[model samples]
Target: MPNQKKTKIVATLGPATSDKETLKAMILAGVDVFRINFSHANYDDVRERVEMIRALSEELGLYTAILADLQGPKLRVGVMSGEVVVSPGDTITFRTGKPFEGNAEEVYMNYESFPQDVKPGERVLLDDGKLIFEIESTDKKEKVVAKVVQGGPLKSKKGVNLPNTNISLPALTEKDVKDAIFACSLKVDWMALSFVRHSEDLMDLQKLIEEHAEHKIPIIAKIEKPEAVENIDKIVAYCDGLMVARGDLGVEVPAQEVPLIQKRLVIRAKKARIPVIIATQMMETMITSLTPTRAEVNDVANSVMDGADAVMLSGETSVGNYPVQVIEKMTSILKSVEGSELIKVPHDPPQIRTVRYITKSVCYHAALMANEIGAKAISTLTNSGYTAFQISAWRPSAHILVFTSNKAILSQLNLLWGVKAFYYDRFVSTDETIEDVNAIACKKGFLDVGDMLISLAAMPIKDKGMVNTLRVTEIESCPV
Candidate 1:
């Protein structure tokens, strides 16, 4: 088996990493999850990548997860006949469906509700906030007139962002519906909804998934908008995971506030026992150079210390010159930070009312008990992978062994921290499950003949709410 890190790494797949050998090497380099970006890949491309990952996992006897990221409601300007350059204090008009041809006076916008949603004096950011424009007025014909506050070369099909306006748009677009169905057909482990603004946005995608998918896949909501921050608690209540998509989020909200927001989101997800990913620009400098700047290393370390389950790479692993080197560097940094004294402190779970306090208390005690007794490993039987997530959040010293009968749940466990998941059918009795766990642990070298182990589970097999049992026993003492 390949050596694993406690803080998981999620690497994106693209032109540089589409081959089988490169991907296999990345998996060996400690990549826990592979993300298929729908914005850049077609349906066929996604299917091929999914097949490759599954095949590699089988050949290597390791579990890896695939996340299909849906591009939601991305606003962009239409084509311009020629590149137009505008300077400061220049007045321009953005007319709905009006293509600009060699003129800087007016440009085309496809979003019909732009004029109705935006008001005068609101900031209009284009090309990833490179050019800033303030709305001067709006016309009855659904056009927005603005004066350029900061301007540069404007190209065709550039993205537009309304930092100060809350535009009215559906969470799921027409293309997203098709992509969601196609991804579900491929049996993706997780579906990530981009630019998720509220809890209802997640509900809309959930209904769509239920309509198409035979098995329910988990949803990962990407918090990339200011509205998402305002409704984070409610949004997190509905999704299985959360991703701090800082690329567009930094553009949508204030740049200085993003760091604090990242810490806040990680804390919220940890308290709720949900997997959270910190994504975008994690190792950006590595794309060009083999080494990352000192600040980037500290950024990743701080994210892990803040309790994020995973840190993701976008272009660094996808289209960069040295993809494998980047993963290795990331793995090294995470390992060094993990062993430092900064990570030795106790976990701080939130004291919120809506969280499952009982479950949190139970998982924390299980880890404490394992530490107190110096057990070789901690084992649990889980169906939805919830108990394993709780244990991972506590960041215990002992390795976690999770046994589940569901294959989908088994694949979903790949995103967890310090967890080695296995599938076991035949849940006849609680004693049988414990015996199986001990046998597997000993057989897999996680435990020895005389090593002590900690076993935790809910009695009666399907009992809900809190874990009801915790036992400490010698591996050789458990009856087969």
Candidate 2:
């Protein structure tokens, strides 16, 4: 019904783009979803933004998605007395102690949580790898001794980085759990987990969601660490979606390898039919300038050309002066590139054998059938966006219209290709489902009186695994 585009755009909200006017502009400029970064805003701020988005959508008679990104266990150096400048030849002491005056010789970490975590021979990076230090001696009572491996001036509360070090820390910190609960209460569409290392990380959060939220929220795993990349298959199985977080990932891994890793991540996710988003600094210069640089434009176009489901804007929209302009530019780029024949990448669809799960097989079969029939569109009523994603992977020419009663489902669909999501009340009967879907089709100009329509839905509403049927019906006439 709606215009079909392969690549979606997710715009982050911050002081620059949080206002109603800016949000409206962003929607008009083609932001498929709005990202609320919990790391920056509080509950009240997010609530207000959500309310505004809902109101704007209602006014425009358009559907949009809201993604709440949870900040997970952000590790940082505790604090320092003042600015501690260290040159190349300086030696620094990084240990737990009261704030004291120090020069190039040594510096003190005022965090009580540090000593228990750091061990001998472990490397600690300061200011996100602008400086590096190796621990020499540990004093549980006094301070630990360390020599600067790389040196730079250290400011108060700069981020700390640990590469290839196994630190014992909870996947979900207290703040993360609290924020997760709050996000569930708000009924957000997607919950992006930061710093996810393994499949168990998602399982733990899923349990917390069940216990506290009493509802299932789709988890989007953010791949910003090496561990997550190494254990990606399991993580993808456990989560609903994946995000290529290139910023911290660039810092954590070799910068030159990020592009290669991004390609691998996208390909792997495509095979599973799981939506993947390319996020962080896709167009960093748009944060200050009205237009993106040539390289940045190429970066975005290349991601779309690579078959990424979506590309996201972080600082470019969150704190950038040209938030609306950036959205417009990205939308334009996606439209232009997606229209070109070059956008079609050859992919070998995986062979799915008949499995014990009938629903899974049904989904695969329906997608194959649609492609073979050369249908103009595929429509499914799904509580999760999985069914739509499965259909999209078939590379059919048809657009996908995923209908749902849950607003959360609509939001999570923002990162999927060829998906135009709509929300309606859960159907109480088969007749209602048919009539509702047909009415929507007519309204959106997706069907004519005699057009053939394919419908897929799970029967017996209470059952979760009942999505195993497809029916083809011809539209008789327009509803009165």
Candidate 3:
């Protein structure tokens, strides 16, 4: 149990790593979070994985978080009679409903508003941008006539991308509501809403969660669309966390811009004290090959050096031949880069609101003081996990040990960078809780004799959403 690496790993569970033994191996290898993709799994599949994750975490005595990813309102072509081969310069008709006879000349799309929302000259990408179409005309009926700029064999249910159109689809589909209800019932730690366009899109999901759940499950906005990038400020302010989902994002935006966007998103989340996950194909080659390309290794390392809270593995772990190997390699890369000069460089704290200013200042100062004093850990007693998140954002050299009585909050912290969260029994006094954590740290070997522990907490311990105190103390006693 100890995660010596600063950056966390989020492993998607599928046929490759779903069994109890494989899950335990993945945890031991280095998976901090388990992601259940609703786009791929049914209710039964999700519930089974959720149960297994909980049971395995308890058996292994670890705090592992689970994220439920909503597919959102994805547009795709309906079932084709067979494969349709289209060459460049071919004219095709895209209709909203089922086609009477599916052929190469005509195709059906599932989204009802696709025809009206899309205008002439806008580009339509299919099968992950493998084929491109330029809309030439829109008829009185809900049909679009398009010229294929890049053509290939089109299969049934392949993805459709409207790169140039302002998508009018709602962020939440009927399927998303059902998935959210199911996720809440399982007490999932976080839910990712895909294809978020603006802050309003996030508000819609937030309202749905509030109306359906007793627990407050945090939402992580999947920033993939260009509209989301344009409105990132408002979206970041509204959501609890963000995911740099570069798969569709790379397709939507220019591929060359993804690196800069990833860096920008990480910095924005850091300034806001929200966790950001760099996801999609981090170790993709490992899906088949025993090892990843050297370039892929650097990609994972670069994300860690960019201060990403977590790096995700999609198909690499979901259905790959080397699930555990991918985790091991990713963990190794993170460890190597974490100790490099790039990661040690300090960043200037961004200008923020007054309350956040104070917390960030305290966190920055605590990290400096801990490094100067050779502290073993920066410990925080957090009620809402906000204080711990800020401390992690500061990227302290010392390990972060968060003591919380709230199990849900503790689970959420599992995804935070450089955070090691543990639940403590309820105490009558703040001093009692601090003392208990101090002793627990020694017992758990997170601290050794004479090692310094920088502690942060808020005044009036009963109050939530405040981080106003900092103390540095030396570990003097043995484990209690």
Please give the RMSD to the true structure for each candidate, in Å.
2.8, 3.4, 1.9
TM-score on alpha carbons, each prediction: 0.92, 0.87, 0.95
lDDT of 3 at 241: 93
- What C-alpha lDDT values do all the predictions have? 0.85, 0.77, 0.86
For model 2 the local lDDT of residue 295 reads 94
lDDT of 2 by residue, 63-82 (tens): 77788898887766555556
Candidate 2 Cα lDDT to native: 0.77
* Cα shift from native, residue 260, model 2 (Å): 1.6
Candidate 3 per-residue lDDT over residues 380-437, each given as its tens digit? 8777787787788778889999988888787788999889998875655668767778
Q: Which is the winner by TM-score between candidate 1 and candidate 3?
A: 3
For candidate 1, which ten residues in a row score worst on lDDT?
345-354
**Better candidate number, 2 or 3, judged by TM-score:** 3
